[model samples]
Target: MEPILALLTAKDTKEALAAFKELEANCLAEPIYADTLESFLPALTAENSCGRGRAFKFFAINARWDSQAVIEKHLTDILGILDDSKAPTLRQCIPYLTYLAEAKPELIPIICEKLDSLALDQYKESMQSLIRRDIEKVLSEFNC
Candidate 1:
């Protein structure tokens, strides 16, 4: 678990996600346990966003925990900037959403507005379907 944290802190989402898979395989992953998840999450759920390399991973990792309270207690939030006017922020949201949709399917609904924002535009339907398919595949893999 510490190694996973180290990987995440190092901004190695790929490695961190790989570690998560291994932990899930063992049924030994821990849900976030910081008592301050609520306190900390607000700062991140911003309409404002960060630079290119420091991409945010929207939802808390949905790990298998010995304590269900840890999962319930955190109350993870997933939000995105759907305004094309905020192109950079919105674009940043795409990858963030991509990662979350796979890693935490519960956040799929959060992308709905963003999906619809592309509506009446070319490839909009395809965009919605693609992300839906991505989350579906992830859920199917986990048998959720």
Candidate 2:
């Protein structure tokens, strides 16, 4: 496992963010860093906000390079996290959705359905609106 993967599990958000940034920088210089997706999936769905945020940030940076794996292995998990109540997490998920929209158009309907079903019951009106706007943007990109 890479040292950067350890940072995704860090208890401190700042530390995790720093590690994510480092991984992003390294991935730019060494594309192989993107291959760590399988190891990072657990962190992406972690109970800790920091872990989830950092993992999503990493995927946003690298998803394009590993689009097939992301689509086949993690699409549902990504959609599952699209709750409007978690505004930040919802925001983090949008870029992955965008990448998938371009890379896998066949999945658009499924993604749209999941987006439509995302519960907004716990969110404020403003957050719900923001989530809807983002979801619409992604869906529109796919012509959904």
Candidate 3:
């Protein structure tokens, strides 16, 4: 876990990606490590995009592994990520939102609302399209 944390906290993108891959491999090998991975949650807001993205992905994986406790603890932070200025970071947050939608059905409307607001923002066309797709995907989950 320390090594994973070190790589994730590294200033370089390559190192952060390495951490992402390492966490992925570990999760695949021992799914229970997802719980332990929760310790990296605070890093999601790292100043570096690479660190934030990797941390978000790691959190998403753990959320998928077991959403109940993770969601209860990090739902607000996860929602807060949608407000990120970085499009890619916001995009990275979608799967976690999707997982939350599945595990906590009541949040679907709020999530969709947030996505709608995000889509209406002045992001590039390509990014807007991606946000639209995410909104569609989340709405589809609830047959909306």
lDDT of each: 0.40, 0.67, 0.66
Best-to-worst ranking by TM-score: 2, 3, 1
TM-score, candidate number 1 = 0.37
Tell me the TM-score of each prediction against the true structure: 0.37, 0.73, 0.70
By TM-score, the best candidate is: 2
Give model 2's TM-score versus the native structure. 0.73
lDDT (tens digit, per residue) of candidate 1 on 33-72? 3333333344343333432112133233332221333323
Global local distance difference test of model 1 = 0.40
- Error in Å for residue 71 of model 2: 4.0
Give candidate 1's total backbone clashes. 0
For candidate 2, give the lDDT of residue 112: 82
Every model's Cα RMSD, please?
A: 7.9, 3.0, 3.2
Candidate order by decreasing lDDT: 2, 3, 1
Using lDDT as the yardstick, the better of models 1 and 2 is 2
Model 3 per-residue lDDT tens digits across residues 1-144:
776766665675665666567767776455665557567777767787666666665665555566447755776675666777777766776766655565456767777777666643756778978877876787777676
